[model samples]
Target chain A: MIKAFIALVRRDLLLAFRHRAEWFNPLLFFGMIVTLFPLGVSPEASVLRVMAPGVIWIAVLLAGLFSLDSMFRSDFDDGALEQMVLSPYPLPLLVLAKVLAHWLVSGLPMLLMAPLLALLMTMPQDGIAMLEWTLLVGTPLLSLTGSIGVALTVGLRRGGVLLTLIVLPLYIPVLIFSTNAVSAAVAGLPMGGQLDFLLALLVLALTLAPFATAQALRISLS
Target chain B: MWNAIWVFFHKWASPRYFYRLSGAVIPWLWALTLLLLLGGLYLGLFVAPPDYQQGQSYRIIFVHVPSAWMSLFIYTFMAVLSGIYLIWNIKLADVMVRSSAMLGASFTFLALATGSLWGKPMWGAWWVWDARLTSELILLFLYLGYLALVNAIEDTRTAARAGGVLILVGVVNIPIIHYSVEWWNTLHQGATVTKLDKPSIHVSMLIPLLLMAGAFQLYYFSLVLMRARVELLEREWRSEWVREMMGRGSDG
Candidate 1:
């Protein structure tokens, strides 16, 4: 069972790697969104700095949401999901593997590229550490929870926009805590407190979301 | 003992049984709800003593507090029903979930609207991102999302199961919303009635508040039972009881 799960994970990774442009698409979208903020608003460095955390976080969240639509779309179309459900392996473990792969492909790239966007926003040097920490702890939760949304909406005809409506409200708390954590660090207040809350949220999502996603898949498949 | 309770719960999973039972009880439930609401309002509005602080405006609590309590209570009730639906493959439980979502969402909206009305006088702002208020707003979204999800799917079973899973997952937010005022730096005031220590308000005020709360509970039961009856008929149109109901309606 473990071997099959790993194999499924590797298969998804390789498939994602083969379409590398799709992987880069979200990063580009993230960057584009961040860039548009300056054009839409004043380009003053101080103004950009003030809005940086929120802009970057919102952009990353949108980018994550964009990529999440495809989390189960391909497997669902090709009967891969059905086969896995029939497989000897547990459905929840299979879902965990898929979410792990989704986090790697969609969420990790956003985290990796966040610093460059932070530079574009003229984020203070001291704030970057907390920014990175927040993204590291927070984005995976977004990916995991977002995948459940993706799974629920996977088989629907007009799912993409509805998916956003369903998922974004749920994402508000994570966004609030993460942005607050970074802002607190920028202010030189104790960062530990908000970071601890973020970690707790992450742990909570990790524990419960996969089961929810697996159940969603069952509903979609049925 | 546990198994017997499980068996009892499982027995009512049938849509036909639930449909007939809810149909039979809805009129009585509606009558009860109407009586209680009228009595509660009279006691709450005319009879209940005004608070020393806010005076007449404090009467908003009679509506706001009960709706807020109903909001949380209905979500928990929906979640429990969804759990039963998932575990027992109960069609009636699914209907209850669907009906409850609508009732819960309305109560959430009522809570927020009444909260805003109350807040304008007290807090001097129409709206604030107070923990309790914000969490309640999020609860509205959760209820909306659940309804939208079930509607989006074409298949009834799929919709029910999908909405069920979402409801269970979203259950995390309930407690967070409940405790947000305590756990975070929020603008909302802390607990008023459910404090562990001595009661916060005078007995006169507390009595109306409790009465209003009971009225809201009855209101929810009345509506849920009514909606459940409609859902039962819609889902079980071909069943014999439904045909009998249709024939009886025509005869009447």
Candidate 2:
């Protein structure tokens, strides 16, 4: 079982690397959004500083979303997802492995790029570490939860938008908690509370999301 | 008792029998709903004294509160029904889900609209990022998402299955959404004093409030049953029971 899971992850990682555009697209998209916010809101440092935590988090969210809509597409198109569903290994285990790979490709890059985006946005130095840490805890959640949305809609021809409408609401807790943690860290307040909540949400998503995503994948195929 | 309950579930699990049963039951439900709504309205509007704080404006609670309850109730019902459909392949459950989605959306919209109307006089704005209000709005989005997913797919069984999983996922997130909204609201601002003082519910107000809640429940049953019958016919158009139903209607 572990071998199959590892093989799936390794295969997904290889596929993701071969398609380098998938690698660059979300990073560029994240940078563009952070740049746009300064223009759309204000160019002043103080304003950007205050807005930085929220701005960065929202951009990270949208960036993850931009990539999540395609999470299952290639495999779904080439019939890999169907084969995974039929494999002797449980579908949920396969789904968790794919989600881990998705995070490694789509979610982790956003984490690495956050400091640069935060610097570009003129976010305070104190909040940068917290911002990266929150993204670290939160982005895997994005992939896990986002995979559920992708699975449900992958069967549809134009499911991308509907996928956003459905999945965005579910992302609310992660957004609220992570943003709060960053802001709290900047303010030198006790952030353990907010971080704990984010941890709880991540745990919940890790436990429940894979099974739901697996079930949704099977249903979409059927 | 468990045997009796199982027997009841088994009977209704059959879509044809459910269609016939709902047809027979809806009119009676409508009559009961009408009676309850009228009674609740009379008690709420005329009999109950004005609220000490918000005055007569508090009357919207009769509608707003019940609609909110109905929204939650219907969503929960839809999630459970969808789970049954996914697991047991119950066609009756899918029809119930299809019938209930729009009704759930309507109830959610009513709750939001009435909430905003209540907010205007109470909060001095049409909408506040109030915790309850935010959660209700998210619930509305969840309903819209479910409806859109189901309708997007061309195949009925696939639509039901896909929508079913989405619903189950949404249900799991609902409590988390509600709690996050509460904490987020408080984290940003101090709790605002709202006019709806739930604990001090005067006996007079409580009577109508519960009655209205009951009325809304009946209305949901009545509405969903009517819609489910039509859904059954549309889905089962080639089936003999529907043809028999149509022929009986023609003969009558």
TM-score of chain A of 1: 0.97
The residue-by-residue lDDT of candidate 1 on A1-222, one tens digit each, is 789779988998999999997688988999999999999998999898888888999998999999999889989999998998888888989988998888899889889999998998888887888899999998898988898899999999889988988898778877777787788777778878778888988898888888888888888988
CA lDDT of each candidate?
0.85, 0.89
DockQ (Cα-based) per candidate? Answer: 0.61, 0.91
**TM-score of each candidate structure, all chains considered together:** 0.94, 0.95
Q: Looking at model 1 chain B, which ten-residue stretch has the lowest summed lDDT?
A: B176-185
Q: Give the TM-score of candidate 2.
A: 0.95
List residue ranges in candidate 2 displaced over 4 A. Answer: B1-8, B186-198
Task: Evaluate model 2: give its lDDT.
Answer: 0.89
Error of 1 at B236 (Å): 0.4
**How displaced is residue B86 in candidate 1, in Å?**
0.2
**Model 1: what TM-score?**
0.94
